[model samples]
Target: MSFDYDLFVIGGGSGGVRAARVAAQAGARVALAEESRYGGTCVIRGCVPKKLMVFASEYPGAMADAQAYGWTVHAGGFDWSAFHGKLEAELDRLEGVYRGILSGNNVTTFDARATLADAHTIELSTGERLSARHVLVAAGGHPVRPDIPGAELGIVSDDIFKLDALPRSILIVGGGYIACEFACILNGLGVQVTQYYRGAQILRGFDGEARGLVADEMIRSGVDLHLGTNVLGMARAEGGVRVTPTHGEEKVFGAVMFATGRVPNTAGMGLEAAGVELGRNGEIVVDDYSQSTVPSIYAIGDVTDRVNLTPVAIREGMAFVETVIKGNPTPVDHALIPTAIFTQPEMGTVGLSEEEARDQEPVEVYAASFKPMQQSFAGRDDRVLMKLIVSRETRKVLGCHIVAPGAGEMIQLAGIAVKMGATKEDFDHTVAVHPTMSEEIVTMSAPVRTG
Candidate 1:
């Protein structure tokens, strides 16, 4: 009746660590396996390192803006090698912290990859086998490379942070957040940056107006955006890489980066041996409670194709412990999860877009667009846009989206309100915060309902 462990978790990323720690805290014996550093993509490459570069890239603008405030600087320069050094040091410190947290919780850590040997057993790369009452896989995902004629000439997200030296010019492919954000960062860092997206606009899934405004702003800030262009392939050329698109001119750059998409890292994990179902994208198929086809098995986070954000993964992991281990029967509510993109001007949103609202309910859209107050003094031409979508019948707020400085910080409050079913009237009734970018949400002018 006693199992080798209470829970065996594969992949010590956000979700796996959270699940292991929570289960262990609840007095369950837990074992966790990770092949690489504990913090996974967010802490190592995808989010954390990318945002750090974004932060570093913004200083030039900040220094320029400081001049308007009567600040003077003699000399300024950016050294890519120095930035890389700091980034690596910080990442190493973080990896140690992740390892400490797991070990401190008494969750046994195995520095090896794991494959499902059977329904109840996991075979480790070290030739060790472990059995548990339940098995949880949160293996996460990896960036994908498209099959082009000379695709190997280009790099993906995994290689972006590892660049030895910054390129003089870079060509970024795809319209996702990674492409958009990196384009802004490199452009701000004085690199001649060109971005290519097959769609008419960047940020395909965002609100139309917001997407348009972001693309326009990025272009104004010196990003050459080539929209509706298909990349044919890439090849090594005279000075660097030559990228040829289907409908556009051939562009040459010091480096090429493809931020196309990511697929779950479920291959060779022996899911078939365990009888677990998988989606077409290779994501683990799980029900509402994150339980796989086999009740004794569970999956969470990007591996499960749920919300791929780190916070959502952590929530799902904790929820799993509460439901499966503690018998509390917790189910995750995925609706209205707030997300932020750390591009130049930044953006944040929760709930549904106006287009999505129309598919579900009659929506009353309220929107406000204006130059931020800082622009009044700093003389910057950029503007901030905020929109609120409300249900016509119920008057409940259906969505909130914004583009500006502090958009991410502001959206969290709105996310909490939306999660609690706050109505349009409730937002209007709330007093506006004075002289703040966020006040625009509560004080938006009444919009004409097209429906």
Candidate 2:
């Protein structure tokens, strides 16, 4: 069939942009449309800005630690205006880079929302209708505030980057990674941060011991964390925002932010009319190959709700291009993904949790909790944890979880070994790096508990 393009990509997110570029590079005609910024969530309002905030928030402690090291380091208060300005500039540059990549790849771009006009046609908000041989929906997701009275008074994670000034005190709601990370980030940035989670503990899906240490550390680090507590309502008061909780009386805070949850961005996109099956959360339903019920259409990224991380979305995009454009079949792999949480004390984890591993097989748990040399030497009471979950029958490391300052960096290397199916013996065979926290991974000889 004669079509205007071989691929019409909706939502110029990391996934959509990648698919469009790869398809075009493979000698296929490609067009992409995005209603918002080119760099999408991760670059524009998510991981990039959040990481910068994490870095900015760490300077105070770094300065204090420096002083303990006998280095005279003078410090000034965090200037929100300055840091936010730089963050905006960096986002602008990144967005430009994304645009440049698409243009350089000879992919047509439209700065307008694109919705499915049919199985193989896209209707742009600009009153343009284009037909393609295949359509790729890579629309991402957005954070949602919980349903409650005066919930509008509370901001989501997106609104954090937009605040002109950081509030003196914030009542944060939710206990997921976003909530925990922001709880840590705002606390470090010198905000009087109080977090409420209805659950019994924070970081629900992570290893129990690891999350336990995180919660304990968060409490010790001066976070007013209230687990098994939830906000009933919110209202504006003379002070700031008045919050009513299930467990406590009304309290006032400078702001109320909801890191409660996120939903896929799939509404009003004409996806239903075009025969694309959507999941319970309005997420597009796709198979292992990312192909929607409609053969001509495919979905990726958070829009599919299949591993919502940015890198996973990019990989899904690559797989889509390889399968559809390059005549190579590739199914998106969503297993054993290593993830890092940017909490006050960072967390990095991969594979199954000890609880999860034990549920499937007999396992040995090896764990250590101690104050690291650097922070201990600085007289900071902060402690770090290293844990390994090994399959008793196979002697393979089923899981590796680390809660330390650089756990994110440590996890990436550990992830490589775990991905390669490294056994507990394989780790023991490696030489330990002296005086390093990570050496604990290799130095632990005996299983602390074999079940």
Candidate 3:
């Protein structure tokens, strides 16, 4: 049957926007609706603003390093208002760009929320009903506060970007990257930061050695990190948030932020009503091609709870376009993704963790941890780590993990090699670029440990 549009996309995040734009460009009539800002989490609240804060938070340490380098640098207090003003402006510009992209692609845009009226129809918040031949759900996810007394007193990751002023002290709860990263960011910004993780170690799924180093560095850098600890309850006190932990005495802080976990944003979207399958976590269940149980309905990105990274979402969107519009039947690849956690020391990892590698097959680990020249000369006690996990029988590099400054940038390049299935000999054959932290990746000749 003919419909009003070939595709109606619910959500304007990176994935939805890209899918809508690409499909429209392929000559399919398209429409996209967003309840909030256009750029979605990554650009509007998640990565972009957080990274800017990461940069803003590093100035104090940069000033100290500047002095060590014989430059006369006078560091001043952080002006959150000024930095936040500029941040908002940049976000506004980005949102406009996203809008421009949709408009330029000839896709109809709606500023209101959209939900499924049926498998082939969408109902917008504005009482407008539209039908489409295919429906794409990319509604994304949201950070949720834990179920505890006075939980409302605490804020989530999104609330971090909206604070009018930085807290003098914050008790950040959670051991995930978001919790650890913000703890480091606030500490760097001259705030008294205390982090509590219920788990034995932070970054639970990452390489044990890498996360251990990060936890140690965070403590060394003045973050009051308490492992195997959790907040039992909270109360609004005269000064700030009075927190009672599972193992510690009650204490007060200017704020308490919870990075406990995130859940799919699928509430009231009528997925179940339309016969779309959802996971226990409210995530839309989808096939490899991002097609939901309903043939005409599909989901991608965080909504599908598959590789929730922004780049992954964008890739899924592209794959969706290729499969649906281009008739290429492309499947989204969710393997060997390289990721960078912007903690104090930073971590970049790709492929299996050492623990995972050892569990699956016999492996050799080549590792080195030493003070880098720049940080050493600056009189900093900071040390960098480079490690490779290689399959013993296959001689293939199973994983590469780096912990140091610029690990993010280094991992991006390293990821390419690992993605190509580079072997130990392949890495060994490459000449080392001396006086570089990453050269260690190529120059490590012997296994520190083999299993």
Backbone N/Cα/C clashes per model: 0, 0, 0
Worst 10 residues of 2 by lDDT: 115-124
Q: In lDDT terms, how accurate is model 2?
A: 0.93
lDDT over C-alpha atoms for residue 30 of model 3: 97
Clash pairs of candidate 1? none
Residue range 1-451, candidate 1, lDDT tens digits: 6679999999988888989998999999999999987998889887899888988999888887788778995546789999999999999999999999999999999999999988789999999999999999989999988888888888898898899988899989999998999999999888999898988889988887787889999999999999998689888999899888987588789998889999998999999667999999999999889999988999998998878899998999999999989999999879889999888788888988888889987788998878988765888898888998898899998889899977888888889999999998899999999989889888875775635
TM-score (C-alpha) between model 1 and the true structure: 0.98
Model 3 agreement with the true structure over 300-325: per-residue lDDT tens digits: 99999978899999999999999998
lDDT of 2 at 96: 97
Q: On a 0 to 1 TM-score scale, where does candidate 3 land against the true structure?
A: 0.99
Tell me which of candidates 1 and 2 scores higher on lDDT: 2
| Order of quality (lDDT) | 3, 2, 1
Q: Would you list the C-alpha lDDT of every candidate in the order shown?
A: 0.89, 0.93, 0.94
- Return the lDDT, model 3, position 119: 94
By TM-score, rank the candidates, best first.
3, 2, 1
Q: Least accurate stretch of 10 residues (summed lDDT) in model 3?
A: 73-82
RMSD to native for every prediction? 1.2, 0.8, 0.7
Question: CA shift at 159, candidate 3, in angstroms?
Answer: 0.8
Compared with the true structure, what per-residue lDDT tens digits does model 2 show for residues 328-444?
999998888899999979999999999999899999999988999999999999999999999989988999999999999999999999999999999999999999999999999
Instruction: Tell me the TM-score of model 2.
Output: 0.99
